[model samples]
Target chain A: MAVVSGSAEQTVAHTPSTPATPGAPGQTIAIEVVNLVKRYPKATTNAVDGVSFSVPQGEIFGLLGPNGAGKTTTIGILTTFVRQTSGEARIMGIDVAADPMSAKQRIAVVPQQSNLDRSLKVREVLTFHAAYHGIPRAERNARADALLDELGLGDRKRDRINRYSGGMAQRLMIARALMHSPDVLFLDEPTNNLDPQSRLFLWERIQGLNARGLTILLTTHDMIEADQLCQRIAIMDHGKILALDTPAGLKTLIPGGVSLELRVRHAREQPADGASPLLAALRALHGVSKVDETGSDEQDTSGEVTFYRLFAPDAGALIGPATQAVLAQGAELRDLHLARPSLEDVFIYLTGRNLR
Target chain B: MATTTSPTASNLADVAQSTPPTLSLIGGAPRPKHSRLGLILIAFLAIFRRDLAVTAREFIAFLIQVLVQPLFLLFIFGKVLPEIGAAQAGFGAILLPGVVALTVVLTAMQGVTLPLVLDLGFGREIDDRLLAPLPVALVAVEKVLFAAIRGLVAGAVIFPLAWWILGSDYTVRTDRIGMLIGIMVLTALAGAALGLTIGVLIKPEQIGLMFSLIMTPLLFTGCTYYPWASLGSIKWFQILTLFNPLTYGSEGLRYAMTPPQHATVYGHTVTFAISTLATQWIYLGLGGTVVAFFILGVWLFSRRVVS
Candidate 1:
């Protein structure tokens, strides 16, 4: 998890500070959720419990989480696809429960699964969607053309949807969602099944859309993708947000620790009866936080190897003394490495488990 | 990297900042007209167009089964087998209308059942429409409309084949053109209404069971193969036939096309009259409309699951 800094807004029922108003021309909040709670009947756990979040206008917001984390459920409630068991969800200051049409008018949702008609050509898909929204015929033509050109799908406009490649299909899905020129676009796992290259391409396009003043709400299971694209992220699991902040703020929760790994030969043999001078001296170091032995069961031609995993506030402060202690004990250090607390490490710290 | 802030304060700040916006767009502004009927119409047209496109793609199957199924049945039931037994006695006169009515009913049922079940169960395409900013009633209406179109096509597709198979010896009632059209429309609507009801009641996986349990029995018992009066010898069977809507639809079509029908009603012998045809049409039209509403009612019950 990349650390994130969230820009907070004090919102009343419908008052979001927007640059669209006087004094501030570009500062506007797009989405807000307050004390959201949704439960499915017969299910033992709540899909979302007391969840809350907000998005600023014209920025890309990411909902990052592992599977079964209620990311999709949150989006569904916001989009009015499912009713919230109890909560307040609003889009662009519109209460979704009170007046869904107004909320829908300002937002478009792209579902995780592909639902395009296989028999219709790509162009027909846009035309049909536009019609469904009650867009006038003449305006639909112009909007469809502009969107197709902008998405670089103009040439393949008339090809049947079944014939489009995965990338093309994904692009068309985005284009279809954009047909209404919505202010906020909700994407549910937009790049779930795409190749790495295709995912990157779509990411660039998403960023471009955000830059052009379209607020985006996206959910993803890919940590690197979130780290690279989202300025803020919410780590969710089991229907609740475990942590929400800037990626850096999240990493800071790891407690100023540097992970140092040292590989040694004859690892199974505890250094001199499990209290070799090397181990005793390293334990006496001032800057080191904690240390543990870690390794897989498999061993190479060399009998058994072991790795010393250390967590320290300052690697530089402890490395010299620790290395000297190991050499004095007549231990052979095969390799040594130092790494800062990464997003994955933060996830592990927050959830007590690794992110897949 | 260290802010040195307490966890409680940080959480409070995060919660305050990330709250969602309110659910209403404007205060006292007029709302958009998101009519349930209008949304249903759009969904209906989309399904109809998609089905037509798919049907177009399988032109060979359509030609063989749709265009030829009734024609082949006409030959075997009206001409070939009739020559060997009592099947030929007024069979052409009766069977043509019977097969056409059957074709209309089958097409209508298929129009409603196959797609509705597939979208609701197998394909899950209904999710796309259900997510629209509209009520579930609109979705149900669309399914009925698509079925109506299919029924119309099925009724019309048989005319040319009937012209060729039965030839000029047919009564060829051009004068009853208006009545024929009326009967055709009613039959289609009744079939579609019943089909929609079944579509909503059963899951896609139970389609085969539905065919075997409901449709097959309905067809066999209804007065499709014989006139109601002809089944007088089987007195109880005649009384049971009235319960099947298809019997009324089929009888109405036969009265409109055939010169006359040797039939009975309410355990009494009667003659086929202009009023008899008109009454049957009226009955079917009313029954179909009621049934359509009933289907909509059933659909309202299961809307959440299908959606």
Candidate 2:
């Protein structure tokens, strides 16, 4: 077998390789958790309750949730930063509680905040991290230089860490984590407050690293990031995994996969509250899973206009009949829209709360 | 890291051609994880080395930090006072050890505590050290050891400076070299341990309170300005001094480096002599303080880092 390498080809995004999909079945598991529970000291409730999931080798998995939803707590247990009240977490098959040293040897974490030591020069950060992993001196120097170059931190090698901007420090932190070439990388809120340009670069870097077959598990409160980068996502809330699936798969969990929005005005110019007749007519259409009078807005009209979203198996099947329903009620179809149910909608549907 | 068009990018082609292993940037390295003990040693030393590098880079600032106060204290007390007839003869002999002890103790304590508080309180910069592959406790131990080294080095610098400044007027005893070494090392370690304990126990904002309430009293009551036994008349005051670790530090060094005879007025003899605490009591005090502080430091460090 050809050993996966962080070669030049991986650095240049290859259209041929799809963003990492869930690994094939029977693939070796890189990280595994079975009914993990963590109750912090003096806490009345468990921080992580019966959480269970596994990431296959080389797959990028995400734990997506709002703050205080136990994402960090679960990661703490997996990374051996905190002990679980009960249950098991294993990295590369080594039970973290039983063998954290071996587990830590195989993994690196790029935390949400930059924890780079401000005392040392930029290059020293990577070299010291590599040294901590027991890379031989000569090997560490080589690896540090290469990482600095790869992460585009070579020119800042001699500058003190405090001089670096937020994004630069973050990138340096990533380089430091990758210095030892760890088998598994954990990214906590990887792009939480990053500028758009820096966020895109980080995305590219994450993809490039994954392209080299590095297994990654990241926790993010960002729904878009979770959708774009993770092969699989676990939506968490109140210390539990409320839902877990591929982004597309989770959207299907909502009864209707598509959302159809319509702006309606009655021919008589009456305030366009949901006219009972129009609601009844649309509810009768095939593929119409659900309907609700969402809101009303006064825009360039003396009377209010009704905004209704109809959920259906397919927007194409419902739009024709839905428009007909508005016309049948002698209402004008002022505007129409179609959108796929997003992960955010899936989260709101499952938890009855918005992430932010 | 956000330097998209950094100068290195232009030379990437040339450097890649010159460096063979540049292509193996992320993965190709043969990671030779050491045995358990070996792993801990390597990680511990890497942390120590990083501190060393930073210390080296800030050599001037560190020198000022460790030297200025001690230099002034030694000069005024050992040379100026005696030469101007403001202090008695054997006063230099009595004062040199106390000054040296104070310098070493303060240096070690400041060395670890200041940075530790900053890193743990707000910066979280210590995370890299905490997450090193070795057991997290070793990393804290490594910090204590490095601080102890700084204390020892500060003591070393003071001795030479003392000689140059005071000339023959201040001759610190070198006869009991082994006892002196033991006292200095133990005192240094104790200072470092106490520093680490304070670092974890206090918050960033409370650092001012710590210096004013904790450090200031620690300095004066340490017996650096006067012999512990001299406070015999103020019995309650003498008893209170025992609570400060620096009290043990100064008295222990005085016991090691100063002579036993009474200090005569207006005599600047090279032979070290002073009336101070019992030799056995000093050793026991220094040793006990080290043990207590180390245990507290280790416990608090483990608690902070692991959480």
Candidate 3:
């Protein structure tokens, strides 16, 4: 292997070519999925059912779901790794099913798992990937080196992939995917197994790449990751997209913006016997939308230590009524807090359960 | 809705798209069955280095498995076969080439199959190769080639050991050396071809069961010891051996090494060569075809399984 000038840890300043602007709306469709359906022959239910969406050029689109929700399945169809039983997926106006090679040429895929050859140095991984894109040998090394520097893998370029930490291996995978300089990239849970710092660093690199005019389509079970990175996200469940919008837009699907969290303080009291009176009065509060039990009921607890996550439209006003109601009931207040509606709320609203 | 595109984005897309326009410089379609000679050499060297890296990590096991198994087989045939009065016209000499051929074939086959099973089951290394834009068939081809080289090395290592153990009593004709090489290549290829088929067909979890059920049975029935023609009275056994590609491989190897007078069946001299070649070609061709099918199966299966 030819050694390059820079050390693996050398920080290469990456301006990223002015971070390409988002593609113009109504210009042309980069990807279009129409009523996609996929069913494994012996499987009881369709893995992907009647899913449809479109990605305009130069956008960071996210498909968000918990495990078994078919987010990866949908990406597989778009990437041409799997054929859809029924539906149409077109990349750059080219139908994937009709002409996979042409569609494949327009995109790159970074799978969830690290698949680098353990025997190969990190740089060879990128170069070999470039070779599959039919990139000329003379140019591959230069481009691969640049990508390594850009992805912050410059220092580890010569090390065998097996020597890489999980984060390092993931960055190398991203670098290999970008070696061809593809128009669009498909990242399937690209940060699945990274540490928090590594995840944040990878997210920054991903953002930089997206800003450089690469249309990125990613899937993840992480609501936080999706909210932080994706400009638009689709919340999918049971093979169907329940809602598609910006993260803030999805959050708005719930009735209230504020959530009032409560703790019942009696160590050996039954909220059920006395909670009914308190619940009715709390429900009658002016700004309260709904009060729902979150954890164990006061009666079931060894001591009366029930916790409830409440939904309220106005925490400013609702807190006053809630406090007064508890005082009137003569129940000791353990803790009471208020916060904005979270992605978990949106998930509960759509799927009737928490994400995990 | 037209919402996201910017001038810079179009400019970047234009640049990325322009690179592929020069693809016509390399002719498209009907790519060569084997990688170019340069790539073949590189692939051979690279795969060997990779195997050695893996072997180095488990040096003790490799020494026993790759080196000792063949040595033990040679010991039994050379020292024990003659001592037990089981000699049939220089059986030790005859056993030497057969064991060498078997070592080569089995090594290559194991080299190809074991990694493949690991990839398919737990490791998933092969899936990375599948994702590469290279034709799926090339992956299978690379594996067979790797096996062929490994097999040759194993055969070379055993050749001298066989000579030392058998001594001067090892009387074998050197006139058929050219044919011996031919038989070696054929046997190696046939074994690799069969390995490829099995590698794809069996899942990783089933690998152990398959070794016992399929590979072990095939090896035992392959006429590894006595020639197929020598089983004349056992009509059922002879007919059964004909279906086995390895039987043809072993017989062909013996025919190439042994002189005409020492040949067990005179009538089979011409017929054996033609049948061996025919069976070997058929198995090799079928093996290649099956490999293709498996690639398709794996691609589809992964998609379906994941979804």
Candidate 4:
């Protein structure tokens, strides 16, 4: 219910010290959403509630959230597909609500679901899309050819889209969206339901597009996808952006920098007095920040094994000491894993629940 | 070992390295610059062409659906009724215009309504059209225009069929060519407007009911089987039938295609009233209805689809 206005420029202007965040300082904004709200007919709540963010030109920005988190709704509003109840949005400095046609001319959208005409051939889909943008027929043809060859869909140009697989259909959709050389592209869950190989292929293609300086706004709930692909991400939930920063920047928000998980056997077999000693010894390590015992149903019923997670500023450096500490406790080490806090962990830390 | 890249990967790499090109597909060559009006025109044509291409691809289905009912009606009413001596010798002439008008209504209603329902409900293909850089109302207008063209085509197809089947008995006056063309165009426009309105108003599930409750009543009361002058004996029915846009269309066609000797002025008062102001009222009614329904349809469509 909070109406936050005039915050888009400030939010995007607060440049992170982290050199990893993409986009140079003072880059022109490709998209700016300010306190956007959309209340569907007869709905009790807004689908997108007072959300604001900006995507800098040439940056691959991500709206990361689970289903019904308003990522798609926000995209819908930016693309002029859905009207907002209040506030403003601009695409390439053109107000979307005030002059949608001009805004639409500069942008292309790949919806979460496939909306391509199934009856049209792959080439026709691209050609028609370009035509919609007032591209000349011959030019559209050449563009379609280049895009088809680029997307690895040249062989299927003549084939009806009905025969295409899920991956092929998605690639075709991307090719169609690119035909107009839109200044900004909005991809809503572009990789949803794709096989792992297809997802990787698409990722590489998207990366290549980004390298060429096309501003992209991508919506996804896959934390790894966002972490790997997005230069900056806005973690959204319940129609609100809970946090917005580079993936690495958001990961840094976690209290302890990294997590260390340890599995030990024979620790539970010792008297109950042994448990607290093991935890205290792990916490007593030089770089260790926090330690907690986590229950696992897979633990041996005969008290043969137990699991413990240790948090530290640097799990890599503490791994050797943490292992010796468990051994000194008279417990046999079974397995161990050290990982820097991930975006998912950051999300969990912020929301008090898993992203799913 | 040296790493190798696939051909597809290399092509993608080439694309990435190449300078992004301006979009040239819209006009023939990429223009250095384009006016906003020029862009809108291109976008509109693109949408129109796509719709036509898709419809043409399904020509067989359209032919079957559009031709069978009207052809059957023509054969039964124009051919059989007169052949069996159950009606006047010139009944074919009377029935021919009615058949054409009916075909226009049905063709347009189905053309606009069915596809719209499918687009909104099942296929969701309209989303692509809506994304074009044009006003949302323009998209709705494009749909109506296309449907009107289809209705005109349906009328053209039914004309020759009815004429051939009815033989010499079916003879339309060619003397009033301007009036004939005007009425025909107006009828198609009115049909398109009505179809567009119904398409936006009715739910997909209610389509069958629309045909039963709306279309059937329209055809039966639309003066397809009788001239408007014949309804004078039944004043209430005459007034009720006026609510049907097709009535004006059918009556307009009758006035344009039939001679004065064969024209029905059976009920004196109603017939005299119609004849005195027949051309003016019919033209006004049809033109006015088209305008009203088209605006209403566009308004409703923009509300439903844009939001």
Question: Model 2, range B1-307, lDDT digits (tens) per residue?
Answer: 2212111232334334543343444443566746888888888888888888888988889988889998898789888888889987657777878788888888898888988898888788988877788887777788888999899989878888887888876666678888888888988998898888998898899989999998889878889988998898999999999888778878878877875554345786343346677878787888887888888888998888766
- Top TM-score model: 4
The lDDT leader among the candidates is 2
By DockQ rank, best first, the candidates go 4, 2, 1, 3
Tens digit per residue, CA lDDT, model 2, A1-356: 01342221212222112223344434556688888999988999999999988776666788999899999999998888888889999877778899888788777888888888877778888888888888888888887787777777888889888888878888999888888877778999999889999998787677666655577899998888888777788999989998887787788898867789999876555434636677778888887878887546566454457778888778777888898889988888989988777889999998899989
Clashes of each: 27, 4, 16, 9
Sorted on TM-score, highest at the top, how do the candidates line up? Answer: 4, 2, 1, 3
lDDT of 3 by residue, A85-117 (tens): 999988777787786655655677888887666
Please state the error at residue B115 of candidate 1 in Å: 2.2
Better of 2 and 4 by lDDT: 2
Per-residue error for A16 in candidate 2, Å, reads 31
Report the Cα lDDT for residue A162, model 1: 76
Model 2 B-chain TM: 0.86
Which is the better candidate, 1 or 3, if ranked by TM-score? 1
TM-score of each predicted structure versus truth: 0.75, 0.85, 0.71, 0.87
Candidate 4 chain B superposition, TM-score: 0.84
* Residue B149 shift from truth in candidate 1, angstroms: 2.1
i-RMS for every candidate: 11.3, 8.3, 10.8, 10.2
Tens digits of per-residue lDDT for model 1, A1-356: 01111222234333342111111233455788877888887888898988887766655667888888889889988887767888899887778878765566567778787777665678767766666656556766776787777677999898877788878887887887776556678888888889998987787677555544567788998877676556567888888888776665667678756677777655335544555445556767787778776654757665456677777766766677767766776666788888667778888888898777
Q: Provide the lowest-lDDT 10-residue window in model 3 chain A.
A: A1-10
